[model samples]
Target chain A: MNRLFHLPLSPFSRKIRIVLGEKKVSGVDLVEERPWERRMDFLLLSPAGQVPVLQLNGTTLSDSTAIFEYLEETIPEPRLLPRDPAQRAEARRLAAWFDIKFQREVTENLLQERVNKKLMKSGYPDGARIRAGSANIKYHLDYMGWLLERRHWLAGEALTIADISAAAHLSCLDYINDVDWGRNAAVKDWYARIKSRPSFRPLLNDTVPGFTVPSHYANLDF
Target chain B: MNRLFHLPLSPFSRKIRIVLGEKKVSGVDLVEERPWERRMDFLLLSPAGQVPVLQLNGTTLSDSTAIFEYLEETIPEPRLLPRDPAQRAEARRLAAWFDIKFQREVTENLLQERVNKKLMKSGYPDGARIRAGSANIKYHLDYMGWLLERRHWLAGEALTIADISAAAHLSCLDYINDVDWGRNAAVKDWYARIKSRPSFRPLLNDTVPGFTVPSHYANLDF
Candidate 1:
């Protein structure tokens, strides 16, 4: 059986969870890890002290992308990355967009304002950062809207790693009602499609202490 | 022929340049891009307003990882990323270390103090940022030293994308004399091997106006 160390609100961790669910790796044990607590075992698992560390057999893997590739090769069923090289590159590009761009601008900001305060119970929220996040999210939502407007999925017709990466971050933000779904109908519909996936059900059910899910959070149709 | 809009100092851009060189992709037109200028063509190529943006065939590829993957797939011979799934994951992990961890602590600070100041040509260097950069770099250098002491390369015996990623960032930092080579002998030796590579010579030859490379910049053994 595999062991996975993760945090509920972490997009990277959620990415791995979704991938595990998608791949149907049922014999794995999922444990919530608080990296900030600086547990010795966690440090031994990953020197960088980040979550989403997976232990398979005797080897441990860090980094969500690395884990994804490992899973793709080890399992190779229900492919997450495209078989065509160009298409695979496209999937990776979109995944990087959400992980780096949207994570930084949208998810990080919302977490700092909504989740971090509740979790850490310290540091007052800055209006400027929150405002910046709101403004930037609109831009990103519009970009996603444009992409979803054209294709059935974020990367293409098939559901790829990109969709999982995006939904991970958006799901976290959605928990605190930071996302304005009304900004774009296409983007909203796209999120709904991704949200209803069997892999996403666990993510949708996640509830953080001192935080409550929005009215639309558990609603599949919303 | 492909077109690359790049800033010579950018590690991400240099990573692609090395990939192009390694793949023997000839007739590549290199256009020096100032991202701050925010040209419409560049924006069209990359909405993130970063370089290197590769206008290859008809598709535009942005983000170094994406561009590198595109090249690797298009040119299957002399691969940069390993063919084995686990090895590929290891390579990506090391690459991510350079891209995310080292970039945040070292490259970002050095760029702000050294290149960003010159590019912006604004106020004097921020003392705190420079101090933070110097202190943080030593720790990273020490960690790299420890890693290199065990393996022939950063990730393993084979020089993978990890080596290229680390060298790309270090080479840029070296241009501004930000790296303290005397800090760690093992790390220095590892860098020397990377410096001696044929693809890296062009990067060393780069000279920005109002900024001068150290005398050892061109010396391969230095």
Candidate 2:
């Protein structure tokens, strides 16, 4: 059996969950981890102490993008990455952008303001930072809207790893009403379709302490 | 002919340059770009205004990792990525760590205080951001020392894309004397090997109009 240490709201963890479900990998135990608490065992498993560490046959893998690629290569079923190298490069590039840029600009802000504060985690919320996040998020959302307008998914017509990465981060923000779906009808529609998947059902049900999701957060149609 | 739009001292750009040289790809015409000048054409090539955009066969690709992967796929002569999927994943993860985490901590500080401040091209520097960058850089350097003690390269024994990514960033900082080589012997040794590479020659020679590199910048054996 494979074991995964994850956080309910972590975008990286959600990327892994989506990959696992898409790949149809069964018998995997998902353990919710509070990384801030800093469990010694978890630290051993992941020196960085970040979530979405996959433990299989005594080998522990960290980093969501890395884990996703590893799973794609190991499983090779319902392939998330394209067989063509150019397409694969495109997927990886989009995944990196979402993981690094989107997370920094938007998701982290929402998490910091909503979850981190509630959790009493490190890093205080500055008004300027939050405002900057909000402003930056609109630009990203507009970019996504442009991409979604041209393709069925985030990267392209194919439902590749890029979609999963974007969805994971955006979904987390959506839960806290950080995303303005009203900003782009195309992006909103795209999210609506992916959000209805069974894999996303668990994510919608996740309730972080002291944080109340909006009414539409769990709505499949949302 | 392949075309590359980049700033000489930009770490991301330097990484691509090394990869191009390592792969033995020819017909690369490098153009130095002034992103802060905000040229309309440059903006069209890359909306983010970040450099290291690779132009091949009428297709423009932004992001160093993406461009490098594209080249690896197209050429695949001297591979920067690992043959094994797990190893490849590790390479990508470490590359991301250097590009984002290390950049936020180390490169951004040195670039701002020592480079950006000197370049009247980018406007005045923010003291608070520079101070934060300096503090963060020391912490990152400490982490690098710990990692170098365990592995020969940033990621593993064999030089991979991660090594290039790390060297690119560190070399930029080295130019401005931001790095304390005496702080960690292990890191210094690792960097010395990287600095001696023929591919790193172009990076070391890079000079800003108003700024000069440190006295030790050109000494490969230093």
Candidate 3:
């Protein structure tokens, strides 16, 4: 059986889970790993000591993006990236925008401070960081709205990994009630569509011990 | 002509430059972009406002990894990624190691402090950050040395994007004389080999104003 070491609340882990769910690749043994613990055995499996380490086909794979690429190559149904090279680049670029840029500007500030810190018992959430996260999320939501206004999806007409990546991060923030869906109607409408997907269903059931899942988080109408 | 908007000291920019050079993709009109200035035209091209934006074949692409993937898919000759799926994953994993982990732990602490601070006029170099970066780099070098001792290249027998990514970050650190190359013989050997590649030659000649490149920086024999 394939094994996936992941954290329920981790966006990167959620991204892979959604990807796996999207392709209907089931039977993956989901093992929740707290990467900060730096368990020696886990480290042996993943040198980076990050979450979403997939043990598939006798291969230990880390890095969510690499894993996604591997999965896409092996399982080509419902292609997440567009066929055109330019479209593919756009999909990847937006995926990266959420993973790298939005992660830094929003997720790190909100989720890492509010949820992970408490889960790990690292330290009290810095009030300033939370404030900054609150401030930054507006810009991101507006940016997403702008893009959605222009296209059906984040990248283009076709649903792509860009949507998966962005939704993964947003879902995590949504769990913490950090995202104000009302701020941008387009972004909210987009999320409502994403939330209804079967691939996103598994994430709705995810529960982090200390953090309460927002009531609207799992609601299809939300 | 195809255009490349880049900054001299940026590891991300260097990664793409080396990739372009490696595939012998030439005649690109190199445009130095100060991303910090947030030129509206550049922002229109790259919403992320990042360096190493590639304008090729009427496509405007940002995000170094995405650009590399596009190039790899389009230009199959002298394949930078291994043919095997698993090997490709490994290459990508290590490439992310440098681009994300190493950048945050080492390069951001050192180069961003010493070089970008001056270029962007952001602030004075933080003593604590430089100390942290200096301390962090040793572990990274040791890790690289360990990998080199086992495999012929960072990923496997064939040189891949993993090497290019690692070299890109190391080259920037090398320019600032932040690397203690003497600390790891295998790493030094690996870097020496990477430094001598024809693709690497362009990066060697890159000069950033207001900061002197170390004497050994451009030397292949160093």
**Candidate 3 clash pair list:** none
- Candidate 1, B-chain TM: 0.96
**Candidate 3 or 2, higher DockQ:** 3
Residue-wise C-alpha lDDT for candidate 2, range A1-222, written one tens digit per residue: 689999888999999998988888777898989888989999887766788899866667888877887898899988887887667877777887888878888877777776776676655677787888889999998988888888888777788888999999988888778888899999989889888887777777888876789998988766
Docking class of 3: high
Share of reference contacts found in each model: 0.60, 0.58, 0.76
Tell me the spans in candidate 2 whose CA falls farther than 4 Å from its real position.
A121-125, B117-132
- For residues B32-142, what per-residue lDDT tens digits would candidate 2 score against the true structure? 887788899998877567788888876778877778878888888788887887678778778877887788766776686667666644567677777787677776677
Best by lDDT: 3
Predicted structure 1, TM vs. truth: 0.96
**How do the residues B1-222 of candidate 3 rate in per-residue lDDT, one tens digit apiece?**
699999888999999999999999988999999999999999999988999999998888999999999999999878999988888999999999999999999999999899999988888999999999999999999999999999989999999999999999999999999999899999999999999899898888988877888899999888
Best by DockQ: 3
Name the lDDT value of residue B189 in candidate 1: 94
**Model 1 clashing residue pairs (backbone):** none
Candidate 2 TM-score, true structure as reference: 0.92
**lDDT, candidate 1, at A140:** 91
Candidate 3 at B210: error in angstroms?
A: 2.0
